[model samples]
Target: MSRIARCSCGRLTVRCLGEPSRISLCHCHACQRRTGSAFGIAIFFARARVAVDGVYSTFTREAESGFLVSSHFCGACGSTVWWEPARMPDWIGIAYGAFAGTELPPPDQQVHVKQRLDWIRLDIPEK
Candidate 1:
């Protein structure tokens, strides 16, 4: 299946050409801050299966795993639409919320449980 995920202002977009490689809820501190929520649902796809459009600004940082993670966001709306993790060179992660009017699959797993809030509960497996 194909899907399109765009920034809040619709300036930047990611065209996903097929099923995602994985979907997961991340409870890491960085993800929480980046999403401004309890967790961030990351939809990962093979880099070869996705195409990005429009000009974007990038923020690169070293992740907990010691790999650099580069986030691409629309400059106008400041919405982070997708990111590239150096640890997973062949994959790209799209913000689940960026895909409007689409019902994507539930997360297959969750990570950084140690940083997860105690009030939140989900039926998904832990990674």
Candidate 2:
């Protein structure tokens, strides 16, 4: 299946093709701040499997794993759509929320559970 992930203003669009390699929920502080939420749901696919149209602004930072992470967002609306972690150069992670009306599968793994807020309970079990 394929899905189109676009910014709020519909300026930047990502055509995510086929199935994702993995889906993950991250409770790390960096993810929390990046998403401005309790956790982040990321759909991972090979970079070549996704096509991006339109220019994007990016934010780069060193992750807790010591690898550089680059987040790409819409230059017009500042809505983050995807991110690339340097450690996995071939992979692209798209924000699950970016795909409206599409119900993706549950996360295969959940990381940084220690950083999760107490009020949030998913019980999706870490892999």
Candidate 3:
């Protein structure tokens, strides 16, 4: 079955068919800023495996990987649905928060641990 994720107002939704290639936690400063939180979880799937609906906006920014990342967000609630990172041009990144569940799988790996908040700690190793 496909996993469906939607914006808070239900104006925007994304459908991901099948399992994701990977899921990870990003502790980079940019992620913290984008999520307005300590870290962000990214569930990745091939670009072609996902479908999106409704009008959205894009914001392009350079990631620590030195690639332009274009994020697509809902125009109504400003919730980010997915992002296309230049590093992985063929993949779609679905924010974990977009999912409609609280007991989602834990991130398999963590990235940018050096930039993680000093008080934030996880037993997972940076990959």
- What root-mean-square deviation over C-alphas does model 1 reach? 0.6
Candidate 2, residues 43-64, lDDT tens digits: the string is 9999999999999999999998
| CA lDDT, candidate 2, residue 6 | 85
Which parts of model 2 are misplaced by more than 4 Å? none
Q: What is the lDDT of residue 38 in candidate 3?
A: 96
Q: Per-residue lDDT of 15-94 in model 1, one digit per residue for the tens?
A: 99989989999999999999999999999999999999999999999998899999999999999999999999999999
Q: Candidate 1 local accuracy as lDDT? A: 0.95
| lDDT values, one for every candidate | 0.95, 0.92, 0.90
Candidates 2 and 3 compared: the better one by lDDT is: 2
Residue 18 error, candidate 2, Å: 0.6
- Measured by TM-score, how close is model 3 to the native structure? 0.95
**What would you estimate as the lDDT of candidate 3?**
0.90
The residue-level lDDT of candidate 1 at 99 comes to: 94
Top candidate when judged by lDDT against the true structure: 1
Better of 1 and 2 by TM-score: 1
Q: Write the per-residue lDDT of candidate 3 for residues 60-102, one digit (tens) a residue.
A: 9988888899999999999998999999988999999999674
Runs of candidate 1 exceeding 4 Å displacement: none
lDDT of 3 at 75: 95
